[model samples]
Target: MAVTRRQMLAGSGAAIVLSGAVDRLFAGTAEAAQAGGRSGYGPLVPDPAGVLDLPRGFRYTILSREGEPLRSGEGPVPSHFDGMAAFRSDGGRVRLVRNHENRVTAKYRVPAIERVTYDPQGLGGCTALEVTSGGRVLSERVAIAGTAVNCAGGPTPWGAWLTCEETEDRAGTNGYTRDHGFIFEVDPRGRRTDPEPLTAMGRFQHEAIAVDPRTGTVYETEDAFDKPFGLFYRFLPKRPRGGFGTLQAGGRLEALRVPGVPDLSAIQEPGTVFEHVEWVKVPDPLAAQTPVRLQDFGKGGITHAQKLEGCYWGGDRVYFVSSFARSRDGSAADHFGQVWSYEPSRRRLTLHVVFGPDTDVQAPGDSPDNICLAPQGGLMLCEDGDGAQHVFGVTRRGTVYPMARNRQNIGTDQAPAWGEFAGVTFSPDGRTMFVNVYEPGTTFAITGPW
Candidate 1:
């Protein structure tokens, strides 16, 4: 059965507060649109290109594609483009740094340079591309290479990309010369750079990170799917103002702890809130044989969530995603997905949105992955769930609306080849939104009323 947003909220025991707010927000919008005979961008229109379907007055342009030659002539653009960010450059141009989530054994990879690569055999890294305000690609080239599983990462306040590896494979294991899981900083301008891993940051299956611009604290999420679920972590740099260099110098790694609440999975209902949460220092940030989450669990240091993914900092709160959680792996119960908001000032974590178990991907509560704060307000979530993938717009009041849909067709096959939509971001000026299709890898620049 398809689980509607209203149904999920009704079932939530303590989520009535959030549910009331959400109902009022949606009611106002729906009522206003009914009076005018149109609501929320006026529904998605089918695209003639058979790629992306957007609403009226919205169009998309293909900027850079996988398997194509790089502008530097080193090699073809790698596949599996994941997390990405855009920075404003001189002359109204935008520089985008994107992660390529390839593996060492993958067929395609960004070429490894002398000092720009950590491991020559490592097959995952990042690339930099320049685009104009008019949505034209100027150049695309390898920015960093020789890393493993370059998944989703956050942009630094100082204008650099923090590319994270989503694996914990050791150096000597699997023909890799260096460690697999760590964060590397990449300069978006293609200037002199060093592709060294920040060992101070713990080694684990890192999914994404969000940096607090005020204190320079880094909040990280893990994407572990095992008996012991992943944890939410924070890294406090020694010299917070020095940016990435301060992180390399070493800092304190800690996990989140909700005082009396040992198991976070118990609060699965939408609008469940936990106040006065604290951070417990991690005993070892660079654990080898034992994972950090397991070690922290032993000491009863923090709570755990299943498949924690995309995270972003917005409106003085850290918003993150727990792709899904189930009791099978020691979780409290089963849920399709969840969105959490951590307010540093209030020292509390609130369950902002909860998705019930439903197979309908077009519904309000599908599994969400890479997320970015919208220029106007709320968030832009990239759907990584079953069925056709879509880009969903989530309002601050918890109303969800489809922004775009993937309609890529396989060769000679009329049936839709549903690929995950990732790396959803917007231009600094908010004029253009960028997103990627995981399979056959394509990056797009979308323009609309938003």
Candidate 2:
């Protein structure tokens, strides 16, 4: 990634400029690498600051917090910071584009900026932050607005952020003027990306996306919590380039189907491989009446799973997360969580890991949402299950360990509540790790000895 400068800086003022830098592992950068080995930097130490408990030598600095007035006066930093990505910016700075997963009913929304605002009536969007390697946030602004449920997303090889909306609400619902549930491209370099939703991508309760740099083909997941659950999808674009606005040219939307496997949750064992997977075209990408997942796709309906979330492209393959599944919740099977990787070259998908029913919900191996690959070694998972929230690290040997815990108590002193961690990413240099606490919606830049 080249270091690019901002064309036009926007914001009320500069960031709070926190001190120090903390590092460990995050997805999508060489410095951060795919993952680490066993005994990852030792055990976790309780944080004295009562924000995030980190492993010994690691420290976190809050770059942007909810309810705090952004330097750009963009409505007190819209809350529910979800999925995010980091880029190499000009002058040794790391540019972050974060998603605010607010709904139309929320009080604070990503302020409607002139060119970047999509639908002023909607309440979810993304914000860009320019921060130095030392954890100093220099400038911030609204990268895109007017979208709903800006959830987890992936970074494009062409150096851009793909923000997904986790909603199927139409313009008539919730007083919205535009249809929800689509992916919006964002440029972190202060470049104005078209606010138009990439409708070519099938819409359904969207979760996250991962793009194959080799083919510019995008793999997407749906987080539908309904009776039939959601299906995994891939978009073959008309234009196969990583360049900005390339996805707007329209594409063919399809769902993955395994011969005998109809539901992904049925696969219980790790290392279980599905070969010769077929892609079934979706009848309705617009979801005008029947959702993409509901559309009929021939003999055996397309494959579906429960709570499919975080996604990232790493090691010549695409990895995704299934937060959790329960038969009581209408799933085919039950498990705490599952991580799977797909190899495009071989057209194969493998169950990399599956959390068993006996797994501890609060443990590092529990339910994982947003995920990132560590260039140096192991994969990082953002905790999203019961008990205390944490950022878990998985070693190359398949061992799971806690890397960071949410210490910020959101509830009363009698009963503390910590928000789940989201958007685990690292700068190009891998000197810093960027993540967010979903509740109270604070973005942290942690730097330490990797």
Candidate 3:
């Protein structure tokens, strides 16, 4: 593909320029989008693109897929699985709340659950699956209501799931329910609210969410396209009390702008963050009702700054991965296609690790879609890209390893390729891990060691 820097900028109104030889290599029209730009990061060392390549001891098993029948007896549900969360309700069994980012028109059937309902046009719909540590499905149910393109969201302290919609267009409009472009909470027990969009969470194209247990502060990301692109936001609960209801009280919304970066507003740089750090509060929270401009960093470009997709809270910091817009050339190129850590306690954010091989600056840096920390003190990343996709692991010291290959490569044409692996998490005991493929629309379990 001839993905040139100029064409990339012109095609998308997002103005920001990428630097380095990597930019020149992708300086054509066709190749720019496919190559997540360039950074020092390269592909995995053993490069397990077509096969499931993990460390010495790890194995993956398919738990569910687009047309697979679950124990619930419901017809084979369609695919489009995105983010997921794992909870241990029984001693040996765990409950997984998985998001299905599908529009109403291209909707998938949920497993048997007479009580559950969804907008014909895919508004909001997530599934609750019961699985064993050995990777067997015990049962599956549809949870959440009236939301579409349920992207990625964070798990709550009280054991609830926050599901996000990646589109501003509502259901019925574009064949999707007008339900929301907001955040909704789902209880594992299958209880749901009246389908409320935590307006406090800001609107735009909602992506992943993370919370500060210390302050009950909720941080969110905007996944919009076009002029505004998107911005990261935080919702401070009205009361000190934190729970699903806390979101209704509303709080604050802030966008990121670093002081050191130059103004690349008109260039369309894919992924870049400003050098200096500063947070600006959105003056009007309701402004999200309509598409609005959040920030104009002038020239620096959006980098560690927030292409904001997935997020999880652990240790003393908040870890988030930018889905796209990583710089391949210039000073900021080193940060493209990487994982970043933000210290909530210290109020500082730093690049925790980089993906890919060393020496070559033009290879693929991982497009980590969604992420979760393992009970073993490590991280699991759902890598999304043009080539074969897979699940990967990142150690505290910054070592990257493979966990599983998305098996959606099998079967008929509509089975879908593992284009974007979003949701990922391990059982609380660290025994079983779950992954979702947003494109092929499936979820699976990974058991064993790495």
The top-ranked prediction according to TM-score is 2
Error of 2 at 28 (Å): 9.8
Worst 10 residues of 3 by lDDT: 32-41
Question: Residue 237, candidate 2: how far off, in angstroms?
Answer: 0.8
Best by lDDT: 2
Query: What TM-score does prediction 2 earn?
Result: 0.91
Which candidate do you rate higher for lDDT, 2 or 3? 2
For all predicted structures, in order, the TM-scores are 0.89, 0.91, 0.75
Tell me the tens digit of each residue's lDDT in model 1 across 1-450.
354443342223112122312321121122231211122454567788788888778899999888889888879989888999999998999999999898866667878866688899899999999999988889998899999999899998888888889998988888898878888888899774468888888898899998898898899999987857888998988878854355778788889988766556666566677778889887778886678887844444678888899888765778788887778787877776777878898997887666665323234536778988666655577888665677876554555566787888543454445678889988888779999988778899998676
List model 2 lDDT by residue over 107-157, tens digit each.
678888879878878888999999988888898888898999999888898
Task: List, residue by residue over 1-450, the lDDT tens digit for candidate 3.
Answer: 345332232222222222221211111122212111111122322424443433334456767777666556655655677888888878688998988776655545444244544454454467788887677788886676456777788788878888887876744477554545777878876765435567777666788888787877777766643433466566767764686566677776766554554322222332333243666666655553445344332454432233557766665656565555534322233333544555555555454334333321222225567877665544567766654565655443333444554444544555544466768887877667777767666676766532
lDDT against the true structure, per candidate, is 0.77, 0.79, 0.58
True lDDT of residue 431, candidate 1: 76
Which segments of model 2 are wrong by more than 4 Å? 1-36, 358-365
Shift of residue 420 alpha carbon in model 3, Å: 3.7
Where model 3 places Cα greater than 4 Å from the true spot, the runs are: 1-56, 73-75, 104-120, 176-179, 192-194, 225-227, 260-277, 294-306, 326-335, 353-365, 410-418
